[model samples]
Target: MTKLIGYARVSTKAQDADRQIQDLLAAGVRRDDLYTDHGLSGALAKRPALDKALTALHPGDTLVITTLDRLGRSTQKMLELAEELRDRNIGLRVLNLGGGDVDTKTPMGAMVFTVMAALAQMELEIKRERINDSVTKRRATGGDLGGRRPTFTESQIRTASKLIKAGEPATQVAKDMGMSHATLYRRIKKLP
Candidate 1:
């Protein structure tokens, strides 16, 4: 039997999934067929409820979500999931996409999703190129593309370096300086 399964997610504990649930129910999904992930950020790759929902879906089943972001905020991840769903013969419907119908089961709907995904991927690539160029230009002009400030002061860094040079273990030096061993190595790499 082809079932209409719904998946909902909220980014934080304070947020509610009721609205999404209501929307899914209104779209003819059975209450028992609804899956929810609470207090889970869309940026996280692992989602237990979403996994269960996907596993429960069989070929010809429809997967529904209130919004595209509820499914995933990352364009690449969303596109990958869409391709997986397509390959598995599961349909997708987003109730709030473009404030209108966005169902992948129909030919027009599939075309719209394909176009949107392509545009999103292109936009991300362009943004990445701009950032890389800006960083390069800034470095050439001695402008600091500042990152997280060093947790250790100059005196501490000097002490740690001396200890490392004296054959003390990196892990021990980092522990003494209240930083991770990886951080100690990264700091050494930055030294002229």
Candidate 2:
């Protein structure tokens, strides 16, 4: 028998997946067939529960989500996932897609999905352009980009190199210099 599986996600621990799960259950998805990734962003490419659900899908099964964003944070990713499902003979159903819901098993659903994908891609591109422009402007004005401070001083690096050249163990050298062994070894590699 064909099964209807649901996937739900929340980006933070403060958010709840109960609302999405309720909607999925109301749509007739079995509780056992539902997968959830809590405290994980949709933007992340690696989601363990989501992967498990996709792997469990069989041909002719339907994958349901409360919203398209629950499937993916970006349109490109959602479209890629949709194409994968279609190629596998699986159906995708989203509860809140514009004026009506989307079921990729139908012709109208396919068209609507394509249009939405295109619009989302355009929106992302525009956002990228705006961010790039803002960054460029800030750089031109000599604003700090914000990053971590250097872990080792020049004198400390030089001492580390000398210690390493003198056959001192990296761990010992790092302990003597009050730094990490890995940091000491990395500084040694940069010695000319």
Candidate 3:
């Protein structure tokens, strides 16, 4: 008989994996066939449960997952896993992709997986570009781009400078002003 393996993952302990487990069980996977990784980031390559699931897969087995994102957030990583499964002659099924079998070897299924991976990669790149643009705009403004804003007013800067000139250490000055040492250093760096 052909075996079916299920993989489930949640990035944080606060997120529940019970629903995924239940779904896999309802899909006819035995408890022993289900591998779970909780409180583990998808970016991690050394996940124990995922490693076990991959090792347990054989040429004729079917690998099932709740969603693509549960397997990995990165398009490259997802594609890598899919390719690995294909190399092993293992079948891949995702619950979100509909209840039926999805044969990656078929032309239509291959096209769909390729398009999904490309979209995921594009989304990540767009997000990174937007963040860079935001940072550039903030730097163009006279804002404190790299450090904490000064809690001390202009009067406080004048006082802190006076204290420093009077031979007080920045640490002591910050302690007296109820600010952190790093904040004091940043304030001093901004000073003329």
Name every residue pair that clashes in candidate 1.
none
lDDT by residue for model 3 over 22-127, one digit each (tens)? 9888888889999999999877878899899989988988888876667776887888888898889887777765445455657677667767767767877898
Model 2 score (lDDT)? 0.87
Against the reference, the lDDT scores of all candidates come to 0.86, 0.87, 0.81
Residue-wise C-alpha lDDT for candidate 1, range 109-170, written one tens digit per residue:
87777766656557657888999999999999999898988777766777788898999998
The model with the greatest TM-score is: 2
TM-score for candidate 2, residues paired by index: 0.64
Off by over 4 Å in 1: 117-192
The collision pairs in model 2 are none
TM-score of 1: 0.61
What does the lDDT read for residue 52 in candidate 2?
A: 92
- In the predicted model 3, the residue pairs found to clash are none
Number of clashes recorded per candidate? 0, 0, 0
TM-score of each: 0.61, 0.64, 0.63
lDDT string for model 2 (106-161, tens) is 98887788787777667767998998998899899998766788777778788778
Kindly provide the TM-score of model 3 when superposed on the true structure, using C-alpha atoms. Answer: 0.63
- For candidate 3, the per-residue lDDT at 94 reads 72
